[model samples]
Target: MSHEEIIKTTQHWLEQAVIGLNLCPFAKAVFVKNQIRFVVSDAKHLDGFLDDLDRELVFLAQAPADEVDTTLLIHPTLFPDFEIFNDVQALADDIVAEHELEGILQVASFHPDFQFADTEPNDIGNYTNRAPFPILHLLREDSIAKAVEAFPNPDVIFERNIETLQKLGIAGWMALGLQASQK
Candidate 1:
């Protein structure tokens, strides 16, 4: 897909799955403020994708928080396998630590095939983290801290998300029309 198409699709997924379903209670605020940056990386290889990742991490770290609070680094063609994507996620963490951004920045991962351990692949709950493509969601630590502080019972977000998704079910998820094509 073209860059514009990729972005539009990702945004649609955000609107339909994340914000529409209230999976991330904190997403709507930044999204409505236009503080989320959607970056589509054209890299076809892992090393090249890491270069994109490094650039985005630096970009997010240096940009003013009010202007760019978070980033969804969308790579359409790389790491199609969820296991490989999970492994690459570790490299992303290492990059943050290497750049001394452990506290300043953190990475959250999402993929079309996101699955929690022991959960069935088609479980509705997995859709909580499912996006149209493999995404590295870069978030500011301070922002997360403040949001968590203001939100009550932050620990229950996961359980709540599972319950919400269970109510939605696989049929409901399919109704959103954002599921990535199965490989």
Candidate 2:
């Protein structure tokens, strides 16, 4: 499909499948100038499987719509499991497919120790490595070596994702709290 075609089709899928799937209680639509976002619920039906384009499309198609896109941020805690860790390759493939997307999607992942705001670099094992956008459950911030295995280098990965977002030019930060009922 042409770039325009891909974007239109993907947006359609997002509206029809992702939002419709109702996979999470918090699925909803988010409208940015150039992109649309889908806030996810605490559901794992399609974890680690979305690293491929086809799989991602399928997921977007199968996702439920009852929820609202409160804050479509991506984080590893959302998909915590060893299986997703082991199948990183497949997951990456699905993500690679997303490149077919005319524009880009921004996903977020945080390291476990990120909460330790006062901790020093040395005190922490090593958070020098860069991680992929939707951090794999297996990769952590402290291990640059492991992070490198996913990309050429952790720094490059960080630089690239950040740069990509900057280039997009229209960015917003939203925090959609998980409802108490989910717990």
TM-scores, all candidates, are 0.96, 0.25
Show the lowest summed lDDT stretch of 10 residues, model 1: 174-183
* Candidate number with greatest TM-score: 1
* Candidate 1 lDDT tens digits, 24-114: 8899999999999999998879999999999999999999999999999999888789999999899999999988999999999999999
Q: Candidate 1: lDDT over CA atoms?
A: 0.90
Model 2 lDDT per residue over 1-183, tens place? 343543444344334323432221112323332223332223354553353323334343334422222122233344444234335435544553455522222223322222123544322211211121223222112222333465544445434433443443222100111111110
As a TM-score, model 1 comes out at 0.96
Work out how many backbone clashes candidate 1 has.
0
**Which portions of model 1 show Cα errors greater than 4 Å?**
180-183
